[model samples]
Target: MLKTGSHIQINDTTLRDGEQAPGVVFTLAEKVAIARELAAAGVDEIEAGTPAMGDEEVEGIAAVVSQNFCTRVTAWCRLSETDVDAALRAGVKHVNISAPMSRLQMRVKLKAEPDEVAARVTRVIGYAREKGLEVALGGEDSSRADLRDIGLIAGAAAKLGVFRFRFADTLGLLDPFSTYEYIKRLRDETDLPIEFHGHNDLGLATANTLAAIRAGASAASVTVLGLGERAGNAPLEEVAVALPRTADARTGVDPTRLMELCDLVAKASRDSIPRAKPIVGADIFTHESGIHVAGLLHDVRTYQGLDPAMLGRRHKVVIGKHSGLAAVRSVCAAVGLDLDNSVAARVLARVKNIAKTTKTLVPDARVRSVARQELEGAETRDMAPARAELRLHP
Candidate 1:
């Protein structure tokens, strides 16, 4: 149902929500470096940080803003004039003013009702506009809120000239189907652009994000490596790579730079990127299974789904317990050892045994050793037969 070639804006929140992950913090230099990388990766916007966190946060956000990258840099703020003042000090031209959308959050966090929340949104947005700041309204805990309340709140913000409305699945609660319906309903309420922000508690953030875009969201809020509070947010790499294929949508993001960008974030955050992570993972394109490798050898399309070349990487073949003769032959050729079928078969058995015993892929050095030993043994046996024939003839 999506319109093909729709342009989706990628608003990266790695500096804001990503740092909210417990025990995670980025130095000012790291923040600037990350911002530069995000810009180079062609993200549309960067949510720098919460300015209201105090002077240090303001300074960090300002440092990133000073870089003057082509990507628009925005600050996340509370629905308060004081936060807006801090954003101004941080020198960002845009701000995302967040307010609780659910009754539970409104009563518990802000001690206010729907009307009161609406009034606060109006006051803060008006103040931000007067200060020459572009504003976006962020609906916190929107997944659990009433659709009517969301419409009312977003309608008020629209009247005040907010550029976008962000529907945040703050608790990561909704599935894709529900996400689609929720976003579709919101899309009908007002003419404002809707951005979808998802959490990964149920491991469905990426899926939910795609659903929201299909339903009507034109912008996606994502963090590098899905780093954020609790389980985390939807990952930037996953969402960017998935958009074109899943929703017939595209972002300005460059797929090739995703790995380098993710690596920089992982190192700065002191977190390790999981080897199996999609798009940016170290092993996503690696193959070892016999059937898969055999198919890949015949025609890469037989077993290939995502082409690694798109991401500036290539398919890697390794020797493992599940590896077959095709894999062994391919790997050996890479290491400058071309083995015939019989020698390859012998090498395969040894590689499997070593992999099973070590509970890991057999290293290339070990494979080469085993292959050379097999080839030498084959030659010795052949020479022995010829020697016996010569002795018998004499």
Candidate 2:
């Protein structure tokens, strides 16, 4: 667990590298809104965009940087000096200088040797620094690169007064254990600040990112709703909310703004947030089991992990197949229906029958209405006219 005392800096890449995801393109207005949301939410850095993509991208990056949202805006770039120049021209005070790290990528793709690439990395950092921009050196496919060579590239950049060494899981090849070991070794051997970037090819990016943080990574590259190329990167909201509760780490993020970012990003990308996604998803804190609802009614911590209030969410006790008497009673109480034992059992059995008959989760309204009918029947049969006490079962 992190000490919960250190300042956890979140670096949101939603506008820049996140757009690299297939079929994603953010308009200038969307980019501006995202940047504003990121800033308002207290993200430490925003990878605004790649100005080198030309006029539109440059204008977008400039618009974000000029917002004065109290966040550092960075632009991504290739190893070319002109890319750095473009970022500078776009008013980005921070630049991520990327280089292919794997032998396959460096030679086969870039057709450049390590010596040549290392020299280029150092040159870009130097030029970016001279241009009054902080330089973050990115290791594209760094996980697949030979460790010794990566160390050399990272070390060379560090010697040049670069800001940080960005180690990437370009292919999502790393699991948590491997990520821990690799990140630990890198941290142990280098004084450069390390930032970990993970992709979700194996559905392990968030897990690996957590491992990397535990192994001394100072920063991470994340996107809203895990948006990125291929399988996607770690979801920024998950990392933001999960870290504080489980690892006892502290991120300077506004918990309330977390879901809003998800919504904003989803709208901008023309995508929808998955209902079952953790932290920012619609159903993460929604409860349906009768037993689960009873527990929540007693104390929200019964089945909940992180507090829903942290994310500007309310506790939702949903009535479904698994619910029992107490769950029904709780919902009834909320709706001003208190049920007795007999009423509770009847309601519970009816809910179960409804669930079985439909083979689907029963919605809260139908369960409550059925319970109300039973309560009305019980009143008509009795002379005392006592209040209905409901106990819903799971």
283-302: candidate 1 lDDT, tens digit per residue: 99999899999999988999
TM-score of each: 0.96, 0.92
lDDT of 1 at 312: 97
Tell me, what's the RMSD of every candidate? 2.7, 6.4
lDDT of 2: 0.85
Per-prediction backbone clash count = 0, 20
What are the runs in model 2 whose C-alpha is more than 4 Å off? 1-4, 17-20, 358-363, 382-394
Candidate 2 C-alpha error for residue 276, in Å: 0.9
**What lDDT score belongs to each candidate, Candidate 1 first?**
0.92, 0.85
Model 1, residue 120: displacement in angstroms? 1.4
Model 1: lDDT to the true structure: 0.92
lDDT of 2 by residue, 1-394 (tens): 2455666678989998444578889889999998899899999999998888898889999999889778888899988888988887899778889999899999987788888888878787888788888888899998998877888888889887887888999999999999999988887657788889999999998998888888888887888888888899988888887766545577788989888887888887778888898887788888887677777778888888778887778878766678778878877888898899999999989988988899887787888899889998898888666789999999
